[model samples]
Target: MLENTQISILGCGWLGFPLAKHFIAEKSTVKGSTTSADKVADLKNAGIQPYVFTLGANNNADVYRNFVAESDVLIINFPPKRVEHIETLYPAQIQEIASHIRFRQKVIFISSTSVYQNTNDWVTEDLVNQPEKASGKAILAAENILREKLQNRLTILRFAGLFGYDRAPGRFLANKKELSSANAPINMIHQDDCIRLISAVIRKNVWGEIINGCADVHPIRKRFYILAAKKLGLQPPEFKEETTVSFKKISNLKSKMLLQSTYKYPNPLVFVL
Candidate 1:
């Protein structure tokens, strides 16, 4: 347990909300920021200290400054949304926050496996980043800025496709037709595992490392999504009987090795809502 520790999380949506709750349960002082005013009550109800931290050129800088100043550790949880002109908006937002982060505070930046181009093979943390999409490129750029600004104070977590909770893969592709990458391996992690990894990192004070957060199992997309939909009683998606060269199986060996003896939802295939 982190005693008398203050942790601030930027972006309390999806993954960050649960993570903040976990830390609060462990007796850590947690301050969380949300872009929505409605979510402020939700965060407070979950035992989190909530603030409205909207992103923009004219965002309240004092709110962010106070948040950073009051925390011992900060986790930057805002990911680049796959939207129009996100390639520019994403990095700018991150840069604004990075500039305000106080000195000597430990930082965690949530990244994505999309930073790696489809390598058609197993990839580890050592693999060179070759982003294919705009979101990927934006995230990679934000990561570089954090590394440069925070130096050894930052830890990067490149999460695989996040599923579980309200984001079940079953509904994602249900009834979709002519899907590509039928045989491509599914690299994903349950939300429980995602929370666990982030918790372990903070508790153990693991810093200055780049770790991949994902399940060990790599079931093919067609098989996994079809089974998922069947279990949910939704329409199973159809996929062409073909294999694509654009695919990569992310390995969590580095995370396992670093977090020693910790395991939660290692195989995403067995994950149930």
Candidate 2:
């Protein structure tokens, strides 16, 4: 049971905030950190032990140290910023956080499916990742950094395109032009699924594993987005009519075999805004 498990989430943003609420409801002791001081009260009101902390900067040494030291499990949920020198800077940022983490402390690092390059086919956990995007490369590097630091004590979860809740797909490409890969598959997951999957990880005590969190079905990009747009009554984005398009279908077989749970929202095309 997650009851009484001391959990600390590094970044209490979209995904982390809901996760905190879930853990709290399950009777787990949740201590969450937010970069924004304005949001501190919000976290506190919701019964989370809040810390207004930032990595690689001026802050209280004792507070930060205690925040990490008191947790049974530390969740690294912050996403790397989209900026220049991310290849080096991102890992360095993670290294700073990793430093505060005890050598034997269990950790869960939230990763992205962007680590895997678009091979125009089904991609699995063991596939060699050769990401072309800067963000993807940075996330992969951070994963490697944490692996070297925490090895078997770490559990890395790579998630596909995040949607559902306040993050609707209709706003992504609404009324946009010149969108390519109309036939490309959309490998996405819902926030509800993400929270359940993470809870399963902590509950099952699954560590030293790289699990992929994604939906069961892959929907064509054009059809999925258009349907999503119509749901929100937004202008459907235009896409090129490509007979053949490159795509990468993220395989969730490992997550299924491990978690043994079904996705609440399996089809992205039916993803209600």
Candidate 3:
């Protein structure tokens, strides 16, 4: 149980903030970090010990060192920025964070499904495919770095395309035109599921493993986006017809088996919020 445990969240935005709140509600102490100073007050108001911490900008090294050192569980939750040489740069960033850890603290690295490319079939934690996109390649590199540093007490959760509440998929391609991959299936998971999956990881004590968090149903990209747009009263986007389908359906069997997770929004087609 998380009762009376100290947990640290490295990137306390969106998913991290909510996860911190969840920890607090469980009677666990939480330490949260943000790159923005504005969010520090918000985190403090919610009873989280907040630190205005930024990677590579090491103006105050002691602040981050204490943030990493104090916690029994550390959740590293951040995405790589789209910058030049991200493949090299992102791993360097992870390497910096990994340096601070006290050897064997339980660490959860919030990774992405982008680590796997479109293989036109099912992609599980077992399959390792070189991602096609620049960002994906960067994340993959970052994952390997973390694995090397905290292999003993680490759990890497690779979530699918995140969408829910304010982050509506309808807003993504609502007014776009001539988008490709119409026939391709969309792999996505909602915000609620992401949070629950993280909690499941801690409760089950599933460490030193890699798990894929996603829905079971894979919906066609064109159809899901159209419904998502209509649900929000947005102009449905147009897509080019495809002769064949291409996709990498992210399998959640490992998460389900390990975390005992049942997705709240299994099908993205019915997702409005």
Candidate 4:
């Protein structure tokens, strides 16, 4: 394990802040980025050296080059919000990053399980990514760019729906609003588990691999949220349709076998309830 390695995190928002703190706790020098100038002081206060960066239709190449050149390991955690012409903007941002990434520096790209299409079958790292949605296709393209350019130095972490801390699952469905797809399978991972998985990758020097960073547990959507609301003494959200909905069940086997990681929140219900 590299006890004193330097790690740079681009896009220090919800997931990025926690990730930066985790690395700092492990004695790594962390450089976290945010588009907002105001967040720099906050990041510095949290023990991360902060950089102001924004990725969109107009990206400053010089800023990206300097950021990538200064670190040993780079974590790309930013996602462009859905907007007009996002399809074009997403790949352009990725290309800018790829062009600037220093040679030999390790990279971990935080992708999403949304890359998997709505298929009933289980999806693993081995399955071909045939994204049905435009966002998923954009992410897949970004992943491909990193993989092709970085070769053996890059690791891709495809996380499921994220919920933990300020993003409590129960709160999302506590009101008497109607819920869609009641029987849809839920695949989620807590913020703590995300940190642990990233730590494991850094510690074990796991590279050139794509791992699913999600909990093993799969529960029906309605049951999961209803139980969460009940636990919190709130009225359960009403279900609109109780029909079966298909999703590619994510597997964390690769993460376990490669990094030898044991999940901090293996069961999503534990935190949901």
Candidate 5:
């Protein structure tokens, strides 16, 4: 069903860039946006019709409106920066984007599994009301805004920690001291599986649903990080002794059942670079 469809991805950064290429490979017309004019050449070289865009409460609407008007599907891949005052800026930008799009068009919102707090329980898409961090709260707020505006035309995908290519988390805390949550179960997804699930959702025309995208296995924090570090010949991270444990395992059953996803990396521990 995607073959001749026009797809536009807003904020074509790490994930969105590859996703745009994926759709283009599937014979779909792909248009992508970047805030940096320097990156326009990169997107154009990757076979994506590139456009310059800056989204916010007061930003120009004609650019975004024109981008949305040309596509059959619009993917909101804009993520809030990890800085102070992100909580307010995140939803404001989404609200502005929501005002430009019509309810009749299809929209896929990129959300995060962080919306589920560390409740030490198995979490699903239904538990989005319990965000623990600023980023989670911001994402949940954006999801709500888009859902209300687009209604049934919207689909929310709450992806777990995305790690693949040069984005490995093992190197993030290498040789770190006194790290907490050593025993907390990790919920991460490879970039390959993420693209597959999203492609399936669009091909099947699945809308008006919330899906969690993650791997099946849940490895403890220390174990996964140590192994990941060793694979790269990097210093293994040290974790403090655990006196209190709190974590959550993100369940991907909704995605499997609804999106019909068969993961490429079912067991995260065996995932090799």
Candidate 6:
């Protein structure tokens, strides 16, 4: 679907690099951004046109403008690390991007399911975002900013906790003395599934919609990690807390209905086992 279209990814860290590679595989011109100059060559080696850039604080508006202006589709994948001042800085970064780009270009803003409050219910795009933390509030505000400016040209994909490659659940809990929320339900999406959902969006040209991107399976946190460790021949992790944490389960039905997309890794538990 995106045979020759130029796609630029802002923030080529864990999620961004794989996304850029996916677009390039689809025969699209991929431009990936990294705040560190050291990563520029790595991105280029993967067939991506890399740019050393960072948003927030004293950002260069000119660079942001040029990148957005040049690309047919722009994906904002940067994470706001300073949660203390995210309310002010996050929206400003989105505004910085929106101010530079034309209204005609389609923008895909990669958000997180952390925007949802821990309500212990299935969350859909139709539900209003009620972020409990500063990070979530900032992302919600950024979504609002994009919607207000780009209108129907903006698409929001709210993803669950990410795990893949070297970042498997087993490794996270391996050799741990104590783990919390062992029985709590784990809602996560593999990196491959994330890329698949994004690719489907690009192929379908689905815009002006807020979609939840997550896997189909939800496993109890403790059991999931124990299984993962067992498969790796490692000792199962021990849990300190038996109480469950209130968390929202994400649904991907809207994405499936809209794009007719099939997840490559629907059950993240499979990877752990």
The TM-scores, one per candidate, come to 0.96, 0.96, 0.96, 0.93, 0.96, 0.91
Q: State the lDDT of candidate 4 residue by residue for 127-223, as single tens digits.
A: 8889988888889988998989999999999999899888878877887666777888788999988988888888888999999988989888888
Whole-model lDDT per candidate = 0.86, 0.89, 0.87, 0.85, 0.87, 0.84
Please identify which of the two predictions, 1 or 2, would achieve the higher lDDT against the true structure: 2
Question: How well is each residue in 47-165 modelled by candidate 1, as lDDT tens digits?
Answer: 89888867774768898898788798999998877789998889989988888888899899999998988888899999889899999999999999899998889999999989877
> In candidate 2, which residue ranges exceed 4 Å CA deviation?
none
Residue range 1-273, candidate 6, lDDT tens digits: 889989989888998898898888889998888889999789989999877777764658777776776699999998777767779988887888778877588889999998998778888888877899899999999998988888989899999988888776777787686877666677788888888888888888899899998889889888888888887788888888755577678888998899898788888877866
Candidate 4 vs 5: which has more TM-score: 5
lDDT computed for candidate 1? 0.86
List the lowest-lDDT window of 10 residues for candidate 3.
55-64
The alpha-carbon RMSD values of the candidates against the true structure, listed in the order shown, are 1.5, 1.4, 1.4, 1.8, 1.5, 2.0
Clashing pairs in 6: 182-222
lDDT of 3 at 88: 82
Local accuracy of candidate 2 as per-residue lDDT tens digits, 1-273? 899899999899999999999999999999999989999999999899998877767756776688898788999999888888888888988888788898668999999999999888889999998998999999999999999889999999999999878999888888988799998888899999999889999999899999998998888888888888888899999998778787799999998888777788787666653
Query: Per-prediction count of colliding residue pairs?
Result: 0, 0, 0, 0, 0, 1
After superposing candidate 5, which stretches have Cα over 4 Å from the reference? Answer: none
How much lDDT does candidate 5 score?
0.87
Comparing 2 and 6 on lDDT, the stronger one? 2
Instruction: List ranges where model 1 is wrong by over 4 Å.
Output: none
Q: How does residue 37 of candidate 3 score in lDDT? A: 90
Model 6, position 134, has a per-residue lDDT of 92
Give per-residue CA lDDT, model 5, range 216-263, as digits (tens).
Answer: 998988888888888888898899998899999999998999977799
Evaluated at residue 190, the lDDT of candidate 2 is 92
